[model samples]
Target: MAAEANADAVLAELEALSARLTEVEAYLHIEEARGRVTELEEASAAPGFWDDAEAARAYMAELAQVKGDVGLVDRAHERLSDARAALELADEMGQDGAEFIAEAAAAAEELTRAIDEMELSSWFTGEFDHGSAILSIKPGQGGLEAQDWTFMLFKMYMKYFARRGWKVTVNDCPAAEVIGIDRATITVEGKDAFGMLRAEAGVHRLVRISPTDAKKRRQTTFAGVEVIPVLPDDIEIEVAPDDIRVDVYHASGPGGQGVNTTDSAVRVTHIPTGIVVTCQNERSQIQNKAACMQILKARLYELELEKRAETLDEIRGPKTEIGFGNQIRSYVLYPYQMVKDLRSGVETSNVDSVLEDGDLDPFIIGYHRWATEQAE
Candidate 1:
C-alpha cells in the first residue's frame, strides 16, 4: 500500500510537471521556434548564405537558440514519458515501484528547473541582448575609497562572469596612485552576456569602514558601471575619419619589454561627442588601436540606442555624476551587511557572498523580471 501511495504521489508530480511544461512550451512558442529553425536551416544550406559573413553568423546564432528552445521542450516530454513507462512496468511486474517513483520525481524536478530557466530567458527580447557586452567601471568621489571600490566592483564582476562560464578581457585598466584602479574597461563574451548585464549599468553605492583610514569610521563610496552591447558587423555605424582623433602613447603597466619602452598604447577620441577610449592591454600598437576602435564603436552604438529610446538619462555617459538617487543598487557592509537593488526591491543580508563570491543571480533575475514588467 505504501509503495502504491508513493507511486501515486510521483504520478501526481509528473502530471503537474507535464502541465507546467505545456504552459512553458506555449509561452516560448515552441512551434514558432521550430518553424524558424527550419527556415534558418534551409537558408544555411543555400550557396549564397555565406556571402555575408556577418548575416550568416547572426542567422546561425538565431537558429541555434531556437533549436535549443524547442529541444528543451521535446526532451522534457520524452523524460516524462519514459518515467511514466518505467512506473507502469514496475507496477505490472508486481514489484516495488519506489525506485521508479523516485526517478520520476527527480525528472519532474529537473523539468521544473528547465522550464524556469526558459521563462527567464524569454524576458531577454532586446535588440542587442544576444551579443557580447562592453563594460566599464569608474570611481566617483570618496577619493581613495572610491578608487578601491572601483577595483572591488571590477573583481566582483570578473568573479560573476567566471561563475557563469563567460569570458572577460580587460581592455583598459588604469591604476590609481594609491592601491586601486581609477577606471577599467572589460569585454564580456558569452551567450546573452549583454542581456544579463545590461541591468547592471548605473551607479553603485558602497558603504563600509575605511580600510585605509586611521579613524576606523564608516565611509561611503560610489562607482559607475556602464554596459553596452557589442554591435554586430551588419549594423552600419559610419564614423568619418575627420570626426575622430587618435593618439599613441607608452603603455603603462607591467608587461613585456616593449610595453613601457615604446608607444604601444592607442587612444581614440570622438570629436563630436568628446568620448575618448584607450586600449593599452595589447603589446602591439596596431592591436591596441583595434581594441580602442572596438570600444569606441560600442560606445557609439549605445549612444544610437539611447537616441532611439529618446532617453538620454537612461544610459548615462561615462562621466555622469554618481550620487544619491542615481544609484540603482547599494551594498552596505559597515553598520550592517546588506545588498539591495532599488529598482527590483530585492534585498539580502548576504553581502559577503554577493561581493566576495559573486552570487548575483538573484539580483539579475529580479531586475530582469522588473524590466519586463516595466516594458509591458
Candidate 2:
C-alpha cells in the first residue's frame, strides 16, 4: 500500500509537469522565439534603418522588448523542463524516495500556474498590440444627450487606462457647443495597448433618460469608436512627394463641407497607396500637413503589416451604432446600470462603477480566453 501511494504521487507529479511544459512550449516558447528571430532578420535586411538617430533608438527599443519577452519565456520553459526530468527520475527509482516526491509535487503546481500565465500572455501576439492605439469617439442621435454620453465614454476609457498605468494623449477633440465632444481621437500608449483596447473598437450604445427632453423620455444614443495601431517610424513605406495630392482648406467648427478660417486644414492623398489622411487641428497648413503625414505613415505601415500577417478580420467598419442593432457593447442606465461586451459575452451590473474606475482586467481576461479557444 505504501508503495502504491508513492507511485500514485509520482505519477501525478509527472503528469502535471508534462502538462505544464506542453502548455508553455506550445503557447509561448516556440512562437515568441520565432517572432523575435523574424524581427531581427527584418531589421537587419533594412539597410540605413539607423540613419535617423531617433528612429534607430526606437527600433532598438522594440527589438529589446521582444528579446526580453523571449528570454523570460525561455527561462520559464527551462525550469519546467528541469522539473519534468526530475519527476521522470523519481518515477524510475520507485516509491522509496519521500523527498523526491515532495519536491516534484511542489514544483509541478508552481509550473502549472506559471504556464497558465504564459499562455495568457501569448494571446497578445497580434502585431498591433505592440504599439499605441488611436481611439476615436463620435456622438450619434439625441442631440445634447448623445454628446454628453460621448464625453462619458471618453472619460471611461481614459479612466480605465489610468487604472492600468497606461499613458493617454488626445490627438484631436472637437468640443460640442453645450455639453460634450463632437468628435475626438486619442492615442493610448503602453505595452499591449492595442490588444486591450481592441475589444472596445466598436459601436457603444447608451440608454438613459434625457434631461434635455422636456417630456422625460428615455433616449438611445450611439457613439462610434475606431482603434488603429500606431507604427514605429523606421517602417519604410515611402510616399513620393509628387504622388501625393495636397489640398488646403479652412478648419471650421461644425457646418457644411467648408468652414473654419485661415485654410489650416490639410489633406494628403498618396495615389499609389490610395491612402488619405487629413488634419485640421493645427493652426498652420504646414503643421497640419506634417501631422497628417505622420498619421498617414503610421496608418500605411499598419496596412502593410496587416497584409503581411493576413489577419485583418478584427478591424471594424468606419461607422458604428449601438444596441442589438449594431454594437459590441451597450451601456444601460435607464432600466438598469450595466455594461455588456458582446464579443466576449462578459457583462457587469455595476455600470457606474465600471465607468467610474474599474481596471477592465476582467474584460481583458475574458477576451483572452475567448481568443485562445478560437485559436485552438
Candidate 3:
C-alpha cells in the first residue's frame, strides 16, 4: 500500500526539494558557518585560549552553534542522497521494495518541513535576530501578586526553553521581598532564540485569586518581560567609566556553597539611563562584573534601538510596550480560565496548558504572522 503512494512522484518532489535546499543553505550562510566552525576549532585548540574564561566560553558556544548550522545542511544533503539510493533500490527490488519507497517518501516529507522552517528565518531581518537571547522579567504594580507573577513568568519561560531543547542558565533570580522573586534574569542559548523570544517582550498581566493574598479575592498583576539579543563579539558597545556606578555584594540565590559567603556579585547602574543590571551567577567578582557589563551593553543597545525606532512597538516587538495600560497578554485563571494575546487576538480557553505546560507557540507564531503582514 505504501509503495502505491506514488513513489515516483514523491521521488520527483524530493529532487525538486534538493534544489530548494541548496538555495536555503546559501541564504542561511551554511558555507560561511562551515568556515567559521573550522576557524573556531583551530582557535580553541591554540594555547591560552581559555585564559579569559568567560570570553572562551562565549567563543566555544559560538563554535558549537556554527558547527550545528553547518551540520544541518550536511545532514540534509545526506538525506537527499539516501532518498535517491532508496528510490533506486525500490526500482531494482520491484514489488518487494515497499518499505524502501515508504522510507524515501517519509524522508522527503521531513526534509520539506525542515527546509520550510529554515526559509522562515528570512522573516527575522534584525541584526541580532538569529543570536541567543537574554530574558528578564520584572514585577510591576501588583505588589506581592506581581512578584509571584514574575516568578511564574520565569518558570513558564524555563519550561518553554526546555521544550525547545535550548540550553539555559539562571543568571539572576533572587528571592523577592515577601512572596516571589525580585526579578528574573535568564540566558537562553539556541538557534534563533532571540528571534523567537522577542515576541514575549513587554508587559504580561495575570488575573487570578492570589495565593499570597489572605482574602482570596481576584487580583490583577503585571510583569514586564524584556528580551534582547546576546550581542556578537564584533558588535561592541562602549561604557564610559564616569557614567556608571558599581556595587559589589554577597551573591544571593542558588549559586553553590561559597557564593553567598564571598562578596562576588557585581551590580552596575547606568547613571544616565538609571538602568540597573546585576550578575551573581559567577563566583569571581571580575567575571561577575564582566557578565554585568555584557548585560548592561545589551540593555543600552536596546535603548539605542528604541531611540531610532519611530514607534516603540517596532523595537519592543509584536507585544505591548511594558506598561500597565499596555499589557501584551492576559492570563486569567479566575472566573474564566483563558489566555489571550491582546495584540494578535490569539486566545485559548485552556489556561492550564499555557501556564503550566508552556504551550505558547501559537500565540508567538500568530503575532509574528500579523507583524509580517503589516510589514508587507
Q: Please give each candidate's TM-score.
A: 0.82, 0.63, 0.72
> All candidates' lDDT scores?
0.83, 0.71, 0.83
| Displacement of the residue 295 alpha carbon in candidate 2, Å | 2.1
98-212 per-residue lDDT for model 1 (tens digits): 6777777787777766666676777777777767899999988788899899989988998999998998888888777776787889999987898889778889999999999
Per-residue lDDT of candidate 3, residues 240-284 (tens digit)? 999999999887772133456888888899999999999888878
lDDT of 2 by residue, 1-376 (tens): 5755864776676576667656666765667666776887698569887778787777677677767667666666676566656656766677665566666667666765555555656677776666677777777766787778888888888788888788876555656778787776677888778876776777788888887889989988888777777766555667778889999876644323334568777778988878767667667888778777777777776677567866645553334344347876777888778887777888889886777885466676677778678779
Candidate number with the higher lDDT (1 or 2):
1
2 or 3: which has the higher lDDT? Answer: 3
Cα RMSD for candidate 2?
Answer: 8.7
Please name the candidate that would achieve the greatest TM-score relative to the true structure. Answer: 1
Task: Evaluate residue 159 in candidate 3 and report its C-alpha lDDT on the 0 to 100 scale.
Answer: 82
Q: What order do candidates take by TM-score, descending? A: 1, 3, 2
Comparing 1 with 3 on TM-score, the higher-scoring candidate is: 1
Question: Of the candidates numbered 1 and 2, which has the greater TM-score value?
Answer: 1
RMSD of each: 4.1, 8.7, 5.7
